[model samples]
Each structure stands twice: as structure tokens, then as C-alpha cells.
Target: MHYQITLAREVFCEGVGLHSGKPATVKILPAPENTGIVFIRTDLTDRPRIEAVAENVTTTLRATTISKGNIRIFTIEHLLSALHVYGVDNCYIEVNGEEPPVQDGCSAYFFAVLQKAGKKIQNKFRKEVVIDKIYRIDDGERFIIALPYDKFRISFTSLNEHPLIGTQYADFIVTEDVYAKDIAPARTIAYEKEIKHLQDMGLGLGGSLENVIVYNDAGWINKLRFNDELVRHKILDVIGDLRLTGGIVKGHFIAVKSGHQLNTELAKEIRQGGC
Candidate 1:
């Protein structure tokens, strides 16, 4: 009996892309039922559209990127995370650049934007992918598993050699209020040693202490919103990546150091399996 939902009205925001280091403006507009979450590159002449679905995911270098032919958008996980938690089933995300605004490198700002716009229930029933059994995706060093559960939840383990962030774990039921308070404020993180290398690779160009949590061997360069913010941010990314499944997923996700690649792969598998 669950129904599709969209924004009650259109809303807009503007900021710099985390990796692109370019200013961008985004508009979130209500869409018809079943439209799902779609992105439009309004800066282009053709105004190409790319649906945020698993099959459209073209890359996961440092962030998830969905593409249609030559048009592409990256660093979308933060916004998508908020949308997933808000149960936004249909919307059109129009952007003038290749990525959405980084916005403190977390879902908090996006979540607030959703709050301002409000939600409207559509007539059609929501499309949901309920896990019936276990589904697993394993890489030698990282893994993600989905198990049948009545509610959407996540259990994540983050392992790092850094003394400050050695190993952290957290489990949470993915509710909008829980996400806003616990998950959305955890900013993206990076090590000081990796910054130069990442920049050399033409990434993280827009990153700063304001939007990213930076750490070195000594300690964190900035205060943490939560003691175990790293793991909680991992869970946030998982929620966002899995939203590419094109429907709301009902399951418990257990992950160990899983990133966008494995997250989207699991989404693709679930979608292809018709589960």
C-alpha cells in the first residue's frame, strides 16, 4: 500500500563540486509518478537526461557517476543518500555542471533542502525491491551482503591503519530522522598524505577542511561530528549507492570497507535478479 512520493514543489541550491572544483547550480523538481530520480544536464545544448539507476552507472572512481552516452554526472552519492532516506521516489535533478554541489561533503544540507520542499504522495504504489534471501558481493579486501529484513538497515565496519581511525563499527535502521541526526552530518574524509596524489589524479580539487575531514599521523585536522563518523559515513554512502536500484530496497545491508563499486554492483545484481 506504499505510495510513490515526490517533492511538493521545486527547490534549488548552488555550490562547488567536490572533485570538479567548479561552481554548479541544481534544481530539484517534482516529477510524475514512476519517473524515478532523474538528472538533466541543463548546461548542454541537447539537455540530455540520465536516470539515476544501476545500469546507468558509468564509473565509481572516487564517487558514483551515472552517464548516458557522452553526458555524465559524478559525486551524486551525498544528494542521493538524502533522497533515499526521505523516500523521494520521483524527482528531476537539473544541474548545470558535471556534478552536484558538495555541500559540506555530507547529506545534511541536501536533507535540509528536502525538508524545505516537503513531500507529496502520488497515486501510484511505490516500486519496492524486497530482499527474499541473502545476497553477497565480495572483493578480496572488501565485501557487502544484503539479508532479508522487515526494515531497511545497515551494519558497517570500517578498518583503517591510522591510529585515530583504526577500526569503527555502527548499525542503524535507515529512517529519515535517524539519518538527519546521525548520518547526514558525517563529512567525507581523506588522509593528508593522499591529498597530493588525489589532486595529481585530477580529483578532490574543490575539497577543503570546510567540506572534508582531513587527518594525518598526528590526529584529525578538524573536530568530528561523531566519534565514529567514518563508519557512519560509509553507511550513508551505501544507502545512496543502493538507491540506484531504481526502487526502495527492503533489507539489511552488512558491509566491511565497501565503497561505491561494490555498493552499485549489489544494486545491479538485485535489479537484474528481479529481486
Candidate 2:
């Protein structure tokens, strides 16, 4: 039987927030079975806690943000993606700021750290969300469809107007090994023309060439880890976003130009549907 798992020991990392640009440190600690993934803002006086679930998701602009009353956490997708892939069911993520560190703008660092921490199996059996029917969310141009499948999988098609990154497609059965080697290392992508506008809006201030892959009208400003890195990153985001369902999902997701908003919406639907 599949058992619930948590970190073997506490582990921590430090970096700057992708959007907030503020320096922050995050510590992951083990929790008991059935606790689920939770986040705590240690910088606040009350030290409010927010469970990482779809119901707490408040914003999905450029990133996913979860809130509990006035307290909030931002840009949590990368970290959650790593934890989900690692099969971590229960943990406490303690952070010194509103956002977790944007290490290398990808899940690779987080995945490596989690691997080093190892896993502790609990007595309780894990419950997974098994999709028995199709669930679809469409917004004209973009759409996401969840289909019944025995394994966790994703088939994504990314579309961009830029000639350099017009259309790309990829499908994979997301296993821990595949995620660590193929999906986790893909860095976040941004456009040169949008950088100034994003910074002006008080976002992506901490982003740099070392972390984000930027491209201009002519071509990419930074080297790509893969020719279809952008679509792979989209799959990474979808994995993280879906983890908000509060359990491992057993199904296949087919997406076309789906972003955080659509991903989270489908997550909420799945949760409410009790699938």
C-alpha cells in the first residue's frame, strides 16, 4: 500500500523572492500523517499558518498565491512541485517572508534539497484523487482537460506568438526520476519587452539572466536547457498547481496554453467533486 510520507529531517534554504525581490529563508520540517502540506509566515507576530490547498488560493496572476485572512504566501508553485514529485504528503514550510525563495527560477534546487532530506514513511495509507470521468475547463483560447488514467501524466501544448517559440508539445508520465532529470531543471521564461513592464508593476524585480530565461524579438537572450524548455516548465507549473488538491492525483491532464489560473480552477473542481 502507498504510505504517507514526510521529510526525514528539517532542511532550509535562502534566496530572494521572484516577485517581491525580498530576501527570505524557508525551512521544511516533518509533520505527522494526514497533516498535508502547510505554510507558516514566521516573520509575522502571530505566525499565521496557511494550508497549501486550492481553497486558500487567492491569486494566480504571474504566479500562485495562497492566503489565510490577511496573511498570504506568494510564488509557491516551484517549491510545491518538488514536494509533490517527491511524494511528500505532510510537512510544515516555515518562511521568513511572504514568498519562498526563487532558487534558480526552477524546481531543481528544491528537488535536490528534498532528495537529500530523504523521506519518512508514516503508518497511515495515502489517499489519491483518482479521476473516473473527464473534467474540462476552457476559456476560448486556452483549455485544460483531466482524463481518467492509472498514472499521473501530463500532455501539454504551449503556444506563443513569438516566432522563436511559436508552438511546442510534450507528454510524459510524471515519475520522480523523470521529474528530477527532465522537468525540474527547466527555468522560468520571460520576454524582453515584458521585463520592464513587469518590474514597473513591482514584479520580477529579483529576476536576472541567471534565474530567468529571457528572449527578444530576434532570439533567446540566454541558453536553453532543452529546445522545448518553455513547454516543460508549463508542465512543471501544472504539477505544482494541481498539488493544491491536498493529495496525489491519479490521472492524465491534457492542456493547451493553460496557466496558473486554469490549473488552479481545475484543481478546485476536482477537490469539490471529491474525485
lDDT (C-alpha) at residue 111 in model 2? 96
lDDT per residue as tens, model 2, 85-173: 99999999999999999989999999999999999999999988789899998999999999999999999999998899999999999
The pairs that clash in candidate 2 are none
lDDT tens per residue, model 1, 1-275: 69999999999999999999999899999999999999999999989999999999989998999999989999999999999989999999999999999989999999999999999999999978899888999999999999999999999999998888999999999888899899999999999999999999989999999999999989999999999999998998999999999988899999999999999999999998898
Clashing pairs in 1: none
Q: How many backbone collisions does model 2 have?
A: 0
